[model samples]
Target: MYRCDCKSNVLSVLLYVSECWKFTANIEKRLEVFQTKCLRRIMRIFWPNMISNEELRRRAGVSTISEIIATRRWQWLGHVCRMPIDSIPRVALRWTPQGKRNRGRPKETWRRTVDRDLKTRGLTLQTAPTIAADRAKWRSLAVASSTRRRRED
Candidate 1:
């Protein structure tokens, strides 16, 4: 009961519009910490009685926040991929800048993250739209991706 409410209400609000978020390591860490804290509180597990995050999540029947975020991102990507070429989001997704950036490591972007996810599934940005055009295939991929545990780097 409590778990369902926390997931449906709190998690939904917490992740609202997250499909467009540029997920960096720091952001991922913060979200994971916040979710762990919330889950611990809801489960009434206080200090001195420690539990591994994996164990806690297993008990709570929840996927990691990263998994949830990744699932949402891919789902959104599929939608964007299926959009008409003239649509703003579709155009934006395929847009490339004409200028060079300041000299350092390139910043991680939402598009880059999506590309990475696609690569993990042996797909590329070029191929993704083709696959996403088929709703059944994209839906299966989305479900499969969500069920697979994320590996920590």
Candidate 2:
């Protein structure tokens, strides 16, 4: 019951609008810390009785924050891809801003993050839409891309 409440209420609130997030390394670290803290609290774990994050997550049946965000982003991507070419979301997905900015390094954008995630699944922006056109295929791909097969260390 506690786990369910944590997932349904806490995680959902924490991850709101996460599908559009840039998901940088710092952000990922912060999210991991926050999740572990929450889990430790809910599980009534205190100092001198530490549990590894993997063990805690396994016990609680909670997926990693990155995995959850990836799943949500891909699901949303599929929805956008399935829209008509002229649809607002489709247009927005393909839109590029004009004018150069002063920059040392380019900040990560949501699109670039999605592209990176797509490459991990051996998919590309060009092919994703066609695959997403088939709902079953897209659903399977989204879930598969986010879920890592558990391995004992």
Candidate 3:
């Protein structure tokens, strides 16, 4: 019997998801369709025994890729929040450069996604860092946020 570490599995899944996102970035399609396609491909790689979508869903019993990404974004947020103010991640989170409006609409950023996730959990930018300082508490919040998002979908 072979056992895979949960952290390694998650990291692998995240890497796969980012790759999928890169491929699908320019293609305009409904979110459901995009997610379904990505999920199918990811499931194929991760769980070969679960040949059907229904079986994959049943056997995996895990959050969707989007939810996992959201969870990870929050986890990163927590880590960045605990870092020094001058740190790169923290600076990136706080800084906005002077730029021309070269687009009709701005693309969604990781920070924006984190903000949305925080809002859904009744948290705010100012308070998130403090809340996330507690490791166990932050993990619970991230997991809960992912599960809640999954249920809504």
| TM-score leader | 2
Which order, best to worst by TM-score?
A: 2, 1, 3
Against the hidden true structure, what lDDT does model 1 obtain? 0.87
Evaluated at residue 80, the lDDT of candidate 1 is 97
Q: What tens-digit string does per-residue lDDT give for candidate 1 at 81-117?
A: 9999899999999888888877895689888888888
lDDT of each: 0.87, 0.86, 0.61
- The CA lDDT at 151 in model 3 is 75
Candidate 3 C-alpha lDDT tens digits along 11-123: 46544534223223333234434544455555544444436544544444544445555565666678888998899878887777698657775666556666777798899
TM-score of each: 0.90, 0.91, 0.65
Candidate 1 local Cα displacement, residue 100, angstroms: 2.1
Give the least accurate 10-residue stretch of model 3, judged by summed lDDT.
19-28
Model 3: residues with Cα > 4 Å off, grouped in runs: 1-55, 60-62
Off by over 4 Å in 2: 104-106, 149-153
- Please provide, for model 2 over 1-153, each residue's C-alpha lDDT reduced to its tens digit, 9 standing for 90 to 100: 767978998898999999989889999899989999898889888778977999888888898888888889988999999999999988888888888756886678898998898897788888988999999998888766655433322
Residue-level lDDT for 4 in candidate 2: 100
